[model samples]
Target: MSTKKISIGSKPTAKPVQPSADEWVEHRGNGNGPEPMKRLTIDIPESLHRTIKAQCAMRGTKIADEVRELLLQKYVKS
Candidate 1:
């Protein structure tokens, strides 16, 4: 009688290569795609910061999203 043997365990495969910066921009720059986000830094009173944090926690939303909504409402007119 003859028997065949098969390999049981094998090494993991390598991860796929990441895209280059230029490729990333080209892939994401389509007109219908979302606009790239920009970072903003500001200094505010500690109390105001605390209030904003608390409000966001109570509303279950991020401070950044809340601020963006407020800014759009205040400055963007239809």
Candidate 2:
């Protein structure tokens, strides 16, 4: 067996690709910018969940947006 020494050299690293502000917001929910959002998970009956989903789809709205509007109307006093 022949003994050989391997040369160790530093390898160049490519910079990570970062999403622009709009792209970030489009993909990930805005969590770091102004008006940051927090996630809320809940359990609901399958039928009710389906109904809400269908209604939101028919109305061209998002379930989260609907829930947020309902919650704001219920709790936030004008």
Q: Model-by-model lDDT, in order?
A: 0.91, 0.90
Best by TM-score: 1
Give lDDT: candidate 1, residue 70. Answer: 89
What tens-digit string does per-residue lDDT give for candidate 1 at 1-75?
Answer: 899999888887998999999998877766787887889898999999999999999999999999899889999
Cα lDDT tens digits, model 2, 34-68, are: 76568999999999999999999999999999999
Q: Which window of ten consecutive residues has the lowest lDDT sum in model 1?
A: 25-34
Candidate 2 lands at a TM-score of 0.56
Model 2, position 15: C-alpha lDDT score = 82
Model 1 regions more than 4 Å off: 1-28
Native-referenced Cα lDDT, model 2 = 0.90
Give RMSD to native, each candidate.
7.8, 8.5
| Angstrom error at residue 46, model 1 | 0.6
